[model samples]
Target: MKKIKIGIIGGTGGIGRWFAQYFQKEGLEVWVSGRRSGPDLPTMARECPVVIVSVPIAATLSVIEQIGPLMPEEALLTDFTSLKAEPVRAMLRASSCEVIGLHPLFGPEAKTLAGHNVVVCPARSRKWLPFVLDLFRKGRARIIETTPEKHDEWMAQVQVLNHLNTIAMGLALKRSGFQLAELLPVATPAFEAKVEWMKKIFGPNAGLYAQIITHNPFVEDVFENYQESLRELKKWIRRRDDEGLRKRIEQAGLFPAVRMKEE
Candidate 1:
């Protein structure tokens, strides 16, 4: 049996490069297209039976529209975008090819798909869906099947919420009189680890993190709820009301976990 050729647009770097290398490691024929190198998108679309858009979230839709139409009817038009809804919709609108929106929960730096969550929002498919599900299963990835809208909603709570919290922490530390050098000597190991994690967004990955925080439609709702929770915490802290603070913690189901640890 002849295996399908997979073409990854934006395969020069980041997650795209990761997939390009990973798929080759799995013994599939792979072709890549990038801004300055490799075969062009139109050529890839025409040649490869599986076309994946692994571009940044900001450019995902445009790339999808570009490559989707060129794909053969039997080809799979897919993306690796974090937020799924828009990309999936754009792919469906652009072509008659089988469309499946994939969001690998972990970053490109991950060593394996094993134990990691890979959300598969199969928007349109008969031929491609089973192949992808089997591929991830063989890789030992934990497959999560959901609608594109639901996937984006979950990301709003997970990625957006987590990144926003870290951003706030980083900003707060910057506003503090102490610099990293000053903090390091007095900082606990956990604190230092957290600062290191925070540095990722503050550095070269800043644009990617910014898109994760800003581009998703559901993030605004997460922000509103976060602000509401913060306001409540501040009110209790300002009042120096120990009982109120304890009540808030208990309400969040924290005390039971602490109690479990002690028992």
Candidate 2:
């Protein structure tokens, strides 16, 4: 097997840094690069055969435009942006290289890729497909291939809704004057699990969450549904309608049956 040389643009960011470290651990010649002066990018891409753009969603296209022409002709270019359609379109317009869009469902905090899911949106090449799949397989990551539009639509629920719900839970706790740790003892296992998720969401950069919610078009509907659900819950509580509340609970109970079985 030929050793792969990887270049990561926006290497200063969390995702990019994680990729650089992971690639290095896999014995690949990995180089970290970004727009800022902290690291050397051109030289790195010049030597690497695979280039990954792990910048912000808003900056992804611009970085792609800048890096596309400079990358070696045979280098495989990909991105770690949450929304893929726009980046895929941009890369298609800007470069003739083998472009792909990737979304790692896990965060930089992830210890390993053993159980993690990665979305791969291949654009313009069958030759590089196996190589790309093999790279992720080496880390034991599950690769899910799909179109860029489908990837973004799925992320609206996976990333946006999940994060928004966590944010809402934290907000509710704040407004209710409830200390999270204090509720742990009396909480059910499900509620406790939710609190743990809240802790993870609140622990890190707010900017990442902001980008996820703001950049994805489908997120607005999720937010609207969240607000509507809260309003209905509030109405049910204020009205003290036991029948209505019971019916609502029963409806919620049916949700699990409608959902896909967990792996």
Candidate 3:
């Protein structure tokens, strides 16, 4: 039985490179395409039975538009975009190929997929869905099957809101003219850890983070809710209401394991 060849567009580095190497290790023939190197986009589409778009957020849709029409009907066309809905729609609209939206919930530098979550939005076919899921399972990744819409909705809080708070803290510190070097000496363990995490956001992939925050449709509501919470917290702090602050803290802790029941 001949194994299907997989082509990863933009697979020269980062998650694309990771996927290219990972899939190769899983015994699949993998080809790659990148901006300045590797195989060309049209060539990958025409050659491989499965084409994975592993480009950056800003370039994803345009890449999809380019290769979507070139893919064969039996090809599995998927993407590694953080935000799902738009890319999935683009793939479906532009191609008759099997479409899936995948978002690996960890960075490219992760050593292993063990215990990591991989969200799979199987928008189109059953042909490649099982193959993809089985591969992730073999890698010890937790496979989360979901719709593109629901995935984007949750990512509003997961990625956008989380990045928002991190960026906001870093900005607040900057605006205060507080020297990070001076603060390090007095920083607690949690503060030190948070500072390191904030460095990741401020360091690389700034554009990717920005796109995730701005492009997500549900993010506006997330931002509103976050601001409202901050304002409420400010009111309690301004009044020096010890009991109000304590109650608020306790209320938040009370629902650690609570899940919303489907309505």
Most accurate candidate by lDDT = 3
Q: Clashes in model 1: which pairs?
A: none
How far out, in Å, is residue 45 in model 3? 0.9
**TM-score ranking of the models:** 1, 3, 2
lDDT of 3 by residue, 67-155 (tens): 99999898899999999999999999999989999999998889988999999999998689999999899999999999999999999
User: What is the TM-score of candidate 3?
Assistant: 0.95
Candidate 1 lDDT over residue span 1-263, tens digit each: 78679898988889889878878877788999888899988899888998889888899888888887888898898989999999999999999989999988888889987899999999889988998888778779999999999999999989999999999999998998778998889999999899988988898999999998899889889999999999989989999999999878877875687867756
lDDT of 2 at 153: 88
Worst 10 residues of 3 by lDDT: 254-263
Q: Give all TM-scores, in the order shown.
A: 0.95, 0.85, 0.95
lDDT of residue 195 for candidate 1 = 90
